[model samples]
Target: MSLLKKYCLLGAALWIACAAPAFSEYTALSTLLAETASKLEWNPLLESGVLVKDTTQVVFTVNVPWVIVNGSRRINVDAVRRQHGALVFPESTAKEIRAVLEQTDIPPKVFRVAAIVIDPGHGGKDSGASYVHTINGKSIRVSEKDIVLNLAKKLHVTLKARYPDKVILLTRENDTYIALEDRPYIANTIPVKPDDAIVYISLHANASMSSAAKGFEVWYLTPNYRRDLVTTASVGKEYSEIVTIMNDMKEEEFTRESVLLAGEIASQLESAIGAVTENRKIKEGEWLVVRKAKMPAVLVEVGFVSNLEEATRLMDDAYLQKIEKAIYNGVSHFIEQFEQSKGFTE
Candidate 1:
């Protein structure tokens, strides 16, 4: 062969040898790329081969045909299937990738609770009223103060048991006179952070001029004149204004929420006690106790002390237990609704 021909033949041989391995490497890379693409459910037509979209700041490479979740110091992806057909990811990598998924379109889980305060009405010198009833040929007198205190105690126990994690507090534990002004003050003064939630309920029994009329009723604070009836009688006009001002502040803070909370508790109590007693239905009232509480506050009149039958039941421990259960159910229902509305599952 001529020198030029020989040289050309040598060059051709070298080129073929180099091209063979290059073709093999390309074929292997193509297979890996296809597998990764199939696993990621990405469109094969849109992307192919190694793509470095950016290289200036943080490098984003599409070399392996897999999506990478970038973390502070590393990148992560779901592990490829193994010989045993097991699909898994490194714990750390899975966490990082999950975080990215959550940030992209999924919401993180959260939890919240509804705090509550319980107040049993009338203590110490305030013995409230009493009623005499003849049952089983025996006369029994049920004192309003004692009956209400026992009911409050039962309510606290029931609520605490039902919602162990939730915060529940009582204004007075024993027969002590907690000044009406100081009741709301204690509620408002609870050391709560900015994000804390709270609700309050004051318990009492109703009295009426007609002893014939009797049933259970719930009260939420309203600006009606009737609310003033209680405060006016309790405190003189001069002190009433101060009380009114203080109550206004509390109402402003909890007006909207108080209505909702009262409705919830009332519904539960009516359901529980109404089965045994006459259905009183939930009523709106401007009772002083409900009006003055700082947080979402309500006053629950379990039954009428004026009624002979209800006054008798009020003394029964078993009947009080039923009322306690109702109060617990109401509080639980309220908390559930509030948490759900806020998107807090826990």
Candidate 2:
């Protein structure tokens, strides 16, 4: 049987999980052809399938991965099938059709960097975690809040210098306290066009009773794509409704992008620090600052200030520069990759 027939049968037996893969992996062109006047015109020698959907045209080349939706080449293409009886296209190709049919809000072809929102965690009255050290019989104290704020400032300076025209906003420029809820608001409020991108980076210093907890880490929101965490039937009515509402508030696309941003930042940071805190690799974190942000967001723990050695290093301006530079480079890398994927140049 064709893949589409198999999936349809399977879906009937068991509800296809996760919103039914946005579109089935193997969608027979025959099915789409039968449903509409959309013609399946292909060249055997060229191994290409062209589906003309009104003004929008979807083109798929077999073996060679890539699809053209409405004349624009899309890289999200998987393998296009030309051998399975007629021709079957990958889900991405069908998704392109679904986007047009369903009127899905497709991202812009060109992505513009609108703003970079920086949140320096724990300020003003909140001293955060404290680390006390003695050097040459002299006592020194370092607070997580202070260290993070300093790093945030350096990062701001570096990013501003790099992208002078782009808006680089900080939740708190000084020692003044900003509530966790307010931080995301500040970022979400940034005026942006539909094609523009806004990234939220929340800086923080880690603290633990065990001084061994050292090294930098980045966090993104846990994936909730498969299950409806917001409306689980097992949970209480009031709580379930609240959770569902909150989960629904989070954009799945943004969460995926946030994960990518976190991974890039953590990889660069681990390289600079010369230590891979395996435990600190890109993982799920529900930090309010990151979770609530409407845009792609990540929370980075620069280092464990609780450790005497790390605390000492945090105090050093040179060390701070290195960490800040890594973060700056990571952000640059992310932007470059994002723009390239969207077919943006220069």
Question: Could you tell me the C-alpha RMSD of candidate 2 in Å?
Answer: 11.8
Over 4 Å off in model 1, which ranges? 1-114, 223-253, 343-346
Give lDDT tens digits, candidate 2, residues 245-344. 2233234446667878898898888778756343377878677777677778899888887887888888889988888988998899988887666522
Per-model C-alpha lDDT, please? 0.56, 0.69
lDDT of 1 by residue, 77-98 (tens): 4332212221223334334433
Where is the poorest 10-residue window by lDDT in model 2?
Answer: 14-23
| Native-to-model Cα distance after best TM-score fit, residue 65 in candidate 1, in Å | 53
- Candidate 1 Cα lDDT to native: 0.56
Distance (Å) between predicted and true CA of 143, model 1?
1.7
TM-score of each: 0.57, 0.65
